[model samples]
Target chain A: MTYCCALRLKDGLVFVSDTRTNAGVDHISVFRKLYTFGVEGERFITIQTSGNLATTQAVIGHLNNHLELGQEPNLYSVNTMFEMAELVGQTLRKVIADVTQDTHNHEQNNYYCSLLLGGQIKGSEMELYNIYPQGNFICATEDTPYFQIGESKYGKPILDRALIYEMPLDEAVRCCLISFDSTLRSNVSVGMPLDTIVYEKNSLHIPNGKRIYEEDPYFRQLSKQWSDTLRRGLQKLPIPTDDYLD
Target chain B: MTYCCALRLKDGLVFVSDTRTNAGVDHISVFRKLYTFGVEGERFITIQTSGNLATTQAVIGHLNNHLELGQEPNLYSVNTMFEMAELVGQTLRKVIADVTQDTHNHEQNNYYCSLLLGGQIKGSEMELYNIYPQGNFICATEDTPYFQIGESKYGKPILDRALIYEMPLDEAVRCCLISFDSTLRSNVSVGMPLDTIVYEKNSLHIPNGKRIYEEDPYFRQLSKQWSDTLRRGLQKLPIPTDDYLD
Candidate 1:
């Protein structure tokens, strides 16, 4: 299981992904679920994936191996974020079809994987897209400026309360980290060693995002402080009436 | 949809349930998901249901309508908390079987629902159980003293942090309420008014259980104060470093 989230805030876009992958309890391994495309002063995009590690890796590998545009559309050649999303969906479908072709000789299984794409082109606004397992996608709009995939439930409450289209990029990144921290504490399937990337809204370049491990001072402080804050908040609330039970 | 949770604390037990039900987006109504039974002085048991409303209601109706001693074997006469949990599970399976019998011709669909049972019987300690759709149940242990059903994710973080086997009954109740408030804020499908029941250990009877509506002053205050507290907590956190964007 994985948890990846990206928020397109006023200042930039914040992307974070956990690196835990598991075939089963005993078969868990660390696999980077994030991939970046392009370099400085050009089109930059970061992709995060969850579900069916085999399928996700295959789709990403196929795209990476054939990124050039010779009338053959691919991630690097896509002109806009919309086109990039379509390319991702098309590639996902192609890869799944290739892998499932021999299923009858084996056992039939549904291919499952989803992706989060967020980046900025030179002239366009930073945007975020949630690509579904079925090779389709939806973009985040002003009404909802973030997309989350994987073990999303344990971390959803804070985002629903604090995330907004107008939030500063720095604050939004903090919010995403706190959200991920909540999920990591609650679910064993999502572990530490997070990969985070930030793309300034109009920079059209990739900034070197931090790789947070168990010892990252800022993350450690945030996790401890957040839990402490919640405990304090809960303790301060007045006790309810004992009338009904008395 | 609904959200129901039961916590077993050293001092007692806490149970909370939301009342909103819907067949589709256009058909939403309020229906209590909690049912209580007791012998006044000997025992008290509270059950909260989630999943298909019809299935849950049918199961409850089966318990309420049948009065014969051996024939019913309902929650009312159960000797132990485990037996009470098993009775709820058996009732659920029976209800599903009865409903699915006509599915072939009527296309009414499968029955799906779960139950959270918690309370005490004479001369016994307070306990909690999560009864599944398949007529099997699991008891909450000292390490895991809480169970949640229906639209559960949004409200799980607080419980993960604040719940402990030795938490005070009052504090447990407050934690459950805050959890419910978080769920209600995030998911429209789970709404109030709510039904909350707290059982004091060894008493074998529930005295602090009641229905809470939107206008309930205590609930209103708790929700408002929780929101204010959360906002303040977020504000107190340190601002992200400028490196956060990189």
Candidate 2:
């Protein structure tokens, strides 16, 4: 399983994803699930993928191939974030169809994938989208400014409570890390070396992104502090009053 | 869907369950999912259920009918908690089999149910078991002192971090409430009017249990305070340092 989330705040977009993937318990491996496509001062795009590693890799491969070949209507050529998401969704569906055609068991095979696509295009507002396996997609709205894929429930409560559209970029980053930390503690399949990218809205350039490992001091401190703070917070809540007995 | 959890502490057992059942988003109703049986000073047992409402209701109905009939090898007549759990599992399997036998589409029907059973007999140690749809069950160990069924992931992190085998009964109750509150916030299918019970070890009697409604004062305070405490706690954590760019 994977746990990847993206927040489309007023200031920018935040993307975080864990790198662990497994075919089964014994066949676990580390695979980067975050990919970036950008043209400095032109446009920027980031995608975090989950489910069917082969399908995700194939979709990413096709995108990269399109760029190398200077293909029209590619990620680099798309005029809008919505169009980019559509292209990615179409590519994902095509890859899944091609891979499963020989199996004669498309329904049973369950070879599907999902993605979070977020970025900016010149002269347009930044946007974020959740692309489904069937080549359909939905963009984030003001009321719902975040999208999470894979192993999402464990980390969702914090995001639901703490995330805000107008929060500072740094605070949003903190919330995302805390959310990721919650998921890591509860699930074993989502492991370390997280890839995180913070895109400042309208900057149209990819800022410095971090690959956090187990030994990263800041992440270590953040995880420890969050845990301690939660325990302390729980302790502070008033115990059930005796009236509960009645 | 339902969210029910049981914890086996040194003092006794704690059970909590939400009372919402839905065939679909449009078809939802309130139904009690927690049941208790006791022979004062002899034995006490509690079962919290989730999954197909009919199957769980049938299983509970059968158990109640057996007691009413004064049947031998019933809950009141069982010699051990293990035997009691085995009987409940068998009864559950029978109920599911009976309900689904008439349907031709059993594979796709998914009329499965799960249960969390906990309590003690006069001479036995307190025990907790998670009974599966297959009529098999597993007891909680010191390493895993709690069990949750249905919509469990949202509430699991708190239990994972705060639950201890030796906590006081009230503290265990507090922990369970926190867990339930987390689930309630993140999931719409698990609603208010929660049923909770606390048993004291070797007492063989049910203590005062709570049916917490949406307007229950203590619960309302707890919910508000918990959310405030969590938000405050998140604020207290140090923000990510700029060194992350390296």
Candidate 3:
């Protein structure tokens, strides 16, 4: 399992993903799930993938091949973020179809994969999309402003409660880390060494992205602080009186 | 759908459940999911249910009939908490089998139900078990002192972080309510009024349990205070610095 989330704030986009992959409890491995495509001063794109690691790798392979060959419909050639999302979705569907063609139990063989794509095109506004396995996608709106894939529910309440469109980039990053920390504590399948990218809106260039490990001081401090804070807050809530009884 | 959780703490046991039931988006109703049975001064048991309402209701009906008829091998007749869990599990399996026996599409029908059973038998320690759709169940341990069913993930992190085997009954109850509050905010399928029960060890008689409604003043204040505390905690966390960037 994987856990990846992207936030499209008023200022920019934030992408974070865990790098833990497992075929079963015994067959666990670390694999990067975040990929980036960009042209300095023109456009930038980030994708975080979940499900069927082979399929995601194949799709990324196809995209890389297209860029290398300067194909007309590659990520580098797409004019807008919407078109880029469509391209990713289509590529995902094609890869799954090709891989499962010889299987007699196509329905039972779930070679499906999903992705969160977020970026900015030079002349257009920043955008975030959740692309499905069937070549369909939906963009985040002002009310939503975020997309999550993989083990999402454990981390969702924090995002739902704390995220707002106009929050500063740094604050948004803090929120995403807290969300990831909560998930990590609850799920063993989602491990450490997170990949995080912060894209400043309209900058059209990827800034320095961080790879956070368990030893990263800031992350360690944040995790401990959040836990302590929650415990303290819970302790402070007023206990119900006998009036609570029926 | 529902969200029900039970904690087997050292001091005693605590049970909490939401009262939301829905067939579809347009059809929603309130139904209590918590039930209690006991022979005062001898034994006590609490059951919180989730999944198919019909199946759960049928199982409960059978248990009630057994008690009313003074049948052998019934909840009252069982000698140990494990035997009681087995009785409930067997009854659940029987109910599902009866309901789906005539259906040609049994697999598609989904006559599935799950239960959390926690109680004490005279001279035995308190126990908690999570009963599955099949006639099988697992008991909670000191390391994992709580079990949740139906729409559980959204509320799980709090339990994971704050639950302790030795926490006071009131503190455990507070944690359960906060967990329920989180689930209520994120899921439309889980709602209130909530039913809460606190069982003190060796006390066979059931105390006056609380039935909390949306308009209940203490519950309302607790919910508001929790939200405010979480927001304030998030604000107090230190924001990341440029050192976070590569």
Candidate 4:
């Protein structure tokens, strides 16, 4: 299991993904799910993936092959963010199809995976897409400025209530972390060492993203503060009405 | 679909259920999910149900028959809270079995349902049980003092973070509503006109719990205030470190 969330805000994009993956509860391992690559000035792209590890790794490997071979419709050769998302989706679908054919998996989703593709090409608007296991995708819009993939519900309410398209990059990162914090506390499948990226809108260069470890000082402080605040905030909320006694 | 949650606290039990039932989104209707009954001063029982509407209504109807006919194993005759839970579970299983036998539903969960049972029999400690579709049930413990059925995830983080065994009953009710508010905001499957019960510990007489409608003033205040407080609280949480730029 994994928890990956991305915010497509007015400023840019904020992406966070946990590092834990497991075949079973006893077979857990740390695997980075976020990747960044593109022409430094002309195009920038980030991918956060979840689901079958083999499928995601194969998709990423195919993307790397495209980059190395300078193939047409590759991440670098794509004309726009939409085309980039389409390219990734097709590659993902092709990979899943090949694997499914090899294993004769007609209905099972053993080779299925999902991806979040976010980036900006030098000329077009910045964009974000949630690519499904079936390789179809949907982009984030102004009214719904975020896309969450995998173990999404536990961390969604905070984002639904607190996030907005105009939120600053720094604040968006904070919100995503809080969302991740909630998930980490409730689900062991989503572990620590979170990978995060803050892309400045139309900047066309991926900023150095952070990897927040379990003992990271700032994360520790934020989690503690948020917990304390929630307890206090809960108390401050008005009590239910006398109608319960009616 | 429905969302019902119950908290087993040191002070008492808190039960809340949204009043939405839908065969499809187009066929939505209002139906009360929370039911209270017991012999005053001797026992108290509240059942909040979710899942197949027919199964739940049939289970309730059977209980009514037991009570009306003065049956030996009726709710009023149950000697302990555990027996009461067992009775409900067996009845639930029987109802599902009867429906399934009629329809030849051997594999599909067409008649499946879940329930939250909370109350006390005089001379026994208060108890809360989450009865499954299979008729097995698990009671709440000191370590885990809550049970939620149907559309539960959206409202779970707050309870996971803030609820404790020692919370005051009024405050617990407030927390549960806030949880419901989150669910209502995120999932259209769980709708408004919530039915809630706050049974005081050791009080055998059932209180007339509130039906919080969409226009209920205090609930409106609580929901609005919660959104405001959450947004404000998000701002107060510290920003991520400059590590992203590292």
Candidate 5:
């Protein structure tokens, strides 16, 4: 399982992805799910993936192959963010088809993978898109400023209450981290060594970003502080009546 | 969809369940998912149901019928908390069997319901069990003193962070409420009019426990206060570096 989130805010866009993947409990491994591509001061696009590692890697491979070949209608060749998302969706579907057709997956293995695409190309607005495995996608709207994939529910409540279309980029980043921390505490399938990127509008390069891990001072502090605050909050609430006491 | 939770604390026990059932988005309706059964002072057990409303209602009905007939192995006849849980699980399985064989369900729908059973018997300690649809159950542990069923993920993170086996009864209850609030905010299928029961250890009867509705003053205050606290907490976190803000 993965927990990947991307938010499009007034100031810029934020992307965060946990680096844990598992075929089973004993077969767990760390795999970076975030990929970045851009030209300095031109266009910056980042994608955070979740689902079958093979499928995601294949899709990324296809994208990279296109970049190497300078193919038409690829991520780099696309003129708009929407077109880029469609190209990704198409690539994902094609790769999934190629792999499943050659494999003998009798249990009807699910090609479950989702992509979060966020960035800004020159002469356009910063955008966020959640692309599905079926070559379809949905963009974030004013009312919905973010998209989350994989083990989403545990961390969703905070995002729903705290997220706003006009939220400052820094606040949005904090909200995203808190959301990730909430999920990391609850689920073991999602682990550390997070890959996060912050893209300022019209700035095509990832000049401000991070890869947070177990030893990252700020992330460790934030996790501890959030847990402590929640404990304190619980302690401050009034207890039930005497009949409800021990 | 439903959201039901139970917390077994050192002081006592807390159980809460929402009242909403939906076959589909268009077929949604209000149906209490909580049932209480016991002889006052001898035992006080509450069951919160989640999943297919028909299956849950049928299970509860069968339990009631067995009690009414004064049958062997009935809830009233159970001397131990473990026996009580077994009885509940057995009853749930019997109900599922009856429904499955009736020839009324065209799709051969398997019974889909989960139960949270918690309370104290006069001679035994308070115990809580999470009973599955297949009549199997697991008791709460010292390290993990709570169980949640149906639409559970949205509320899980807070419980993961705040709950401990040694938490005070009221603090646990408050945490449970916060959990429910989080679920309710994220899932429209889980709604208001929450039935809550708090049982004191060795005291088999609750003198002041009741259902909380949308307009309940304390709950209203709790919901608002929790959201406010979370927002304020987010505000205090340090902003990321302004390297990308350029």
Candidate 6:
């Protein structure tokens, strides 16, 4: 029901997420799934969520609650990005456990949700992680360099084909949006506008990134031109040797 | 698992399928999923299957049994493509139902399978139908001229971007192969050595179609060139307006 991706490139980290949330067909709504946390220049972190809306919101709420209440072991209290990931994963797992406690099916994951956690600490390396519904997490490595959660397959081929570890930050942004474009066109559950955030490594600050609305000229042109380019490119490919069959 | 796609284009029909079949990672094997049946010069029908291999093979077996026994309403006796579609659907449904009858869970569909049936009968229009496991089928119209079954999403965006009912048959075949290439790259469940069959509307007879092995020269060229083109094409797309942020 969502298309969210984050990449850890040479220059920085890029996070992108769709805002469409749906509960069955009739209960569709727009909700921002991108959240940023940490002390301004000391650290920068963003979490893009997908799956059960209630659970994701509840997880965010609990994390915020920790911050607001000045809990001893909160987002602000974490030092390295690894601890931040552990805290977020623990909180996510706890929230799902609390919400689905009344359900008889322990295996029922109606309340399960996942998150893409990415950002950097003051002196730490830029990092990206895919946090699982079960509170486990995996870090992005040079070979992986990125993570995508929810409605990922339709948009994945392009990323697999084009994205690289050393990609320029600007090109990576376009690549993610193009991935998003593929998803938005094929799946109704993932809609515009997309929320994106970019964090420069060691700058220890995160910008609001960009919100690409459906009507944004650049996005519109990008989507249309990409489709046109694909059509043209497909035509350019040589036909089979057995054209006589035609 | 498998990746099979069928396109109903203005020129004719194109069916493409991967040969990977795996009960588990350790038990992987190669098996053809493309099949043809008809009374040549009168009717030519091709079926591309996906899902439970046993169910699909059993369905094929039953159809062959009917023909061998000279049973009424056999594939050879079908007068129209619609009838052919119906016969395939019924056989598929019967094969699944019979196999799963001993299991108590009616909701359990471990034996489920799906098929894409396409071809023409003398004096009738060329038609393409997607037959579901429940013995129901839907025909492809101008607006929806293609059907993909099994591990479909990874390869779908390219088709959505370029395939059209009026597309040239040669181009359609190439497009289908590219789609297969995408799926094969992203999924271990779908594998190499593609089987492709092209049918010209009134040709009435069918050739054993092309087999594209992993080492095949043209296929290797297309796959390599496609990745190169995509990488180049991706670089050409305009970066976001916030390039200064980089």
Best by DockQ: 4
Candidates in order, TM-scores: namely: 0.91, 0.96, 0.96, 0.97, 0.94, 0.97
Candidate 2 vs 6: which has more DockQ = 2
User: Per-model C-alpha lDDT, please?
Assistant: 0.83, 0.88, 0.89, 0.89, 0.84, 0.87
Q: Residue B145 CA error for candidate 5 (Å)?
A: 0.7
- For candidate 1, what is the TM-score? 0.91
Q: Candidate 6: where is the Cα deviation over 4 Å?
A: A243-246, B243-246
lDDT of 2 at B160: 85
Worst 10 residues of 2 chain B by lDDT: B237-246
Each model's Cα RMSD: 3.0, 1.7, 1.8, 1.6, 2.6, 1.5
Off by over 4 Å in 1: A68-72, A101-109, A241-246, B66-76, B98-109, B239-243
The 10 consecutive residues of candidate 1 chain A with the worst lDDT sum are A102-111
For each candidate, give the interface RMSD after superposing the true interface residues on Cα.
1.8, 2.0, 1.8, 1.4, 2.7, 2.3
Report clash pairs, candidate 3.
none
Q: Rank the candidates by DockQ, best first.
A: 4, 3, 2, 6, 1, 5
DockQ preference between candidates 1 and 4, better one: 4
Q: Could you give the DockQ of candidate 1?
A: 0.57
Clash-forming residue pairs, model 6 = none
lDDT of 5 at A186: 84
Docking class of 1: medium
Candidate 6, residues A1-246, lDDT tens digits: the string is 999999999989888999999888898899999998867788888999999999999989999998999986888888888998899999999988887788878455888999999988887788788999989999999899999999999999989889999999888888888899988988999999888887777888668677778899998888888888788888888778863253
Q: How well is each residue in B49-74 modelled by candidate 6, as lDDT tens digits?
A: 89888888998888889999999788
lDDT tens digits by residue: candidate 4, B73-188 = 99998888888889999999998887777575555496799999999998899999999988999999999999999988888989999999999988888889889998888889
Residues B1-246, candidate 1, lDDT per residue (tens digit)? 889998888888788899999888899999989888777788887888998888988888877776444465766666788887777788888888887876774454346788888888888877888888888988899999899999888888898887889888888888899899888887899988888887878777656578888898888888888877766777777877767666
lDDT of 1 at B210: 81
